[model samples]
Target: MDSISSRIQEVTPSLTLAVTNQAKAMLARGEEVYGLAGGEPEVDTPDHIKAAAMLAIQEGKTKYTAAGGIPELRSALSEKFAADNNLEYAANQICVTAGAKMACFNAILAVVEEGDEVIIPTPYWVSYPEMVRIAGGKPVLVETKESNGWKMTAEQFEDAMTPATKMVILNSPGNPTGAIYTEQELRDIGEVALSEDIVILSDEIYEKLVYGENKHVSIASLSKDLYDLTITVNGFSKAYSMTGWRLGYTAAPKPLAEAIEKIQNHSVSNATSFCQYGAVAALKGNQGFISDLRDEYDVKRQFVLSRLKAINNIRVVEPKGAFYFFVYTGQLGLKSMNLTDKLLSRYKVAAVPGIAFGYDEGIRLSYCTTLDVLNEGLTRFEQFCREH
Candidate 1:
């Protein structure tokens, strides 16, 4: 009638994007602002992929395609899963969406019902719980300790389950935490999932960003049973620097995949047709660009860790993958938002407050910018901490 629905009302806006945008506004006004709030890579999209898109446009491949995705892209994705992740998926089992986030959203909405419980670990990506809430599901958050490397143990998973539990979301090389669950650890969790018959949404968007000896293993790849129960979500945003292209996909069981496709039919129809050609190139082209990006991010990761270790009064869990350091600011005795505001207003640096990610004692700093920019931001951040 007179106003928006309660569903829309319940959604909290993304504080991460808000802080990044605010920092950009300051820079536009000639202020020297160092922004660490954004979650995108600074690298430009690879030239080969861009060329593919241009070729698609020239060939007039811009018309509407299938609601799921073009067969070519889906076929490439199927091969990607088999070769890289050690998981086999038919082209029909894949649903290409606008982004990995949308793949997750559609998966949650397709299976989760009112009052169903979706288990999410603490200090998770800000979107998971909200997406569950939007689907009329209860988000049951289980806290994972910093001492535990922000990983949920099998015991913790067991304790969180209930008769109403419908799904569990996993972000390996997790956002904010950068924690990748080890193979044995995933097996332990997978054991619980199998025993409980809970569906797993494995978000492996940052799969290519691991550091040191940490290997990214798809939990679904561990066993046939686990594979049957998992919906593996991935995209080109992180690995290929294709965030603006809005391409991501999911490989699920055929039945679940069809349900997601039906939802897509009524929603945004499908991902852009020509952009999908770029995605195909991303999957099939020479992957040397990824190794270069990883080498650069590895350097940044080491620099970030060293800098954080030198700072006093803050404890940062050393991250093994992804581009963030989730620093604990609890000892400062200020709420995370207040701490972020102080950093922004006093030092002209931006980072997402930890409260936005379901933790109150910390903030998240992304190292997706250039090394010089990151160094400058950390300098201001250190000065702010010292002055306060």
Candidate 2:
């Protein structure tokens, strides 16, 4: 008999983590490996944020507070939502988790029941489907066209809906593909969700990283109906370069917030006590760090875009937000896994296989590293394409 529960058996490990681990292993062996597989920014957390955490420790704030989060952090986030996203979420209606990832999982587990369906667009974040499956729900994948900038349309969402459909996940400045949904586009989709009373899990973790004319609009802020049906998830990982801090929060209606809080109560208990203070500092302290980070990412994005355009047999859409490029590598005559394997093994550049994001024709490359690393990595990548 199988020792593991069937639920645990059904989940697939994260391919992105696997690739990154292999790259780290190569580097440990004193090998020169260009790592572009990581999802977080390659920067240190702001000094003020670190100071806040240290101060908390100095003040003896190590004990566990409420499972959701400290009142100060939640209240600060409440103000942040009002000021940044134009959404009103009372402190009681927010639940802070270990990371934005936990916030998403708690939200999923709070609403998704056995045999329920959750709609996720293609080229989704690697963890979405796994999270849904972990909650005993079915993940309905809708294939989005690269021509449409890898965004799911209202019509496509409506067509995929069934009686079992309970939620739809939207990641603006999406991972793998940095597709930002416009306000009008969100309104169209919101209308359908409202009619069906379907919940919307809006992941805006990369909201502050957006560039050019693209704006990050929270679907929950579009209208009252959409607001009632949405769960907004954000964190300090990407924006504040605090990935190791493991701070993220979810703002939903009171009932959903309470349910997610209950889940947190039984699991990790709460986000690190001192880290909550750091997150509070992130929200209330200097806002200039965000704009500076966005500017740097934008510069790197443009540099990578130009280099990829100069190479043959690969096509990439210029990302409007976020630091990733979902490069089409189908013309190289290999699926994403094999392509990435050869790229890593032969060319010594590490990148994530597109199949991990449900797009086998492409691979995902992050420009979060230094420009020198990106330059050398892209050079080797160009050679790989030429030989193929």
In terms of lDDT, the best-performing candidate is 2
Q: What's the TM-score of every candidate structure?
A: 0.98, 0.99
**Candidate 1: tens digits of C-alpha lDDT, residues 6-87:** 8668889999988988999998999988888899999899999999999999999999889889999999998998899999
TM for candidate 1 is 0.98
lDDT per residue as tens, model 2, 260-339 = 99999999999999999999998899899999989999999999999999987999888889889999999999999999
Clashing pairs in 1: none
> lDDT of each prediction vs. the true structure?
0.93, 0.94
Superposition error at 122 for model 1 (Å):
1.2
Off by over 4 Å in 1: none
Clashing pairs in model 2, backbone N/Cα/C closer than 3 A: none
